[model samples]
Target: MKLRIISSALLMIAIVGAGCVSNKKFAQLQTTYNDLLNQNRALDSKYQIAQRDLSGATARVQSLEEQIASQRTGLAALQAALDKCLNSTSQGNTNISKLVDEINASNRYIQHLVNTKNKSDSLNMVLTNNLTRSLSREELRDVDVQVLKGVVYISLSDNMLYKSGSYEISPAAGETLGKIAKIIMDYKDYDVLIEGNTDNVPISQKNIRNNWDLSALRASSVVQALQNNYGVDPKRLTAGGRGEYNPIASNDSDAGKMKNRRTQIIITPKLDQFMELIEKAPEPTEGAAAADSTSGS
Candidate 1:
């Protein structure tokens, strides 16, 4: 009976020891679980902070990309503007060169016209001097010699050239006509026109109707005398008449009537010279023509 009691006491002590070991192992496991949970929370917080930093970096990158795109657009616009400005400058240079050439051509043409006029004036002066030197003072009283607009005019009184109230050439007129014809023959390039003038008085001659007929007949007589008597070329002579018109003086007095009853010999250069000058004239530019018009006004 003592052996059975000792066995029962030992078994009870083993049971108590087993129960204490189980409680200690369970507490250690709980402590390990709490530590693991705290580590997981800390890791989650770090991951959230990292994610926020990444999001901020992404937003900055997007902003930088947008600025770069806007800068590229502005650069393209500036390039287009620069190219347009360069092209316009080239065109402006071309226009300026063309304008300079036109101005040079116009200046040359103006100088040519001025030179031609000077030569014409010199020739007219020489012709006038020669005619004056050839005629005597007494003969010049009955004749009026002058130069007008590059032409020579020799006006003779009716009394000196014809018989009284007649178209017939007088004996005294031969010396004067011969001397005048000699001077005309020296200038082969000149053309001659014989013009007759009459007073307002009515004619009483036979075969002569009115003043027109008388004046025309007188002009014809002078032209015939130059061609037939004075050995002048008929092709170079033209006959015209002013019956009671183209008078140098009034028809109210006797002296004025005498002056009106006269004949004129006009000498001039051929028509071809004038035509050549006209054909050589250059076409004017728009700017030059406008300037010329403004200056003329």
Candidate 2:
């Protein structure tokens, strides 16, 4: 009985020792597993930080590249401008002051021409309006006044100016001519042309030779009346005759023949002022050689 009790106690002690050793081994394995998990987590966090830093660095590099490219373009443009400035300086051999002066002079001359033309156009409008108002005083059945291509044309019926086959002015016609002279005297910058037209009829008079002589004498008589009687400038007067050739109406009927025989006064504005503007403008000098040539001359 004693030996069995002792064996049983030894077996129970061995079982307890084996169970404790197994529990210690299990605890050691669990600790090693936890340490490995912590190491893996730390490595993952470092990899994420490295990836974020790498992305930021890449973005910075791209921005720097773009900035560098823009700088290069600006440098290129500046270099091109410098090259152009140098080329212009060498080729033209002209200083900035001289070039500026020349440009200013050219601009002034062009502006002067524009101003002169505008003034001429305004004057023409005023003159045309005044003449129209003055000529409109006479009845349309007696006379006709019109403006064509900057010239004023005044046409009078044959009965208004002269008698049949005679170049002498009637008393009534002289009064009408005086009114016309007043209009002419208002404008001094115009030339006057007086023309007489006759119908296709054979005119045989004691003093007058033919239709040609009658037409010519009528035009001269009108011009003389304007100059001598009305005090119009003689230099502005011109006379012409169209006998049986230039007619406004056909001479087949008496009314048409009467219409064909008429007088025309044409007034044209003088353009001497425009020509003087051009002649008065300073011409451009060719080069610096102008001074040397002038001195030598």
**What is the C-alpha lDDT profile of model 2 across 46-161, one tens digit per residue?**
56435643554466446545644554564465345444544774433334334444445555555555555456446545655576564433334456555433666777787888
TM-score of each: 0.58, 0.49
lDDT of residue 282 for candidate 1: 61
The 10-residue segment with the lowest total lDDT in model 2 = 287-296
Go through the candidates in order and give each one's C-alpha lDDT: 0.71, 0.68
> Candidate 2 deviates by what RMSD?
45.9
Candidate 1 Cα deviation (angstroms), residue 209: 1.3
Model 1 lDDT vs. the true structure? Answer: 0.71
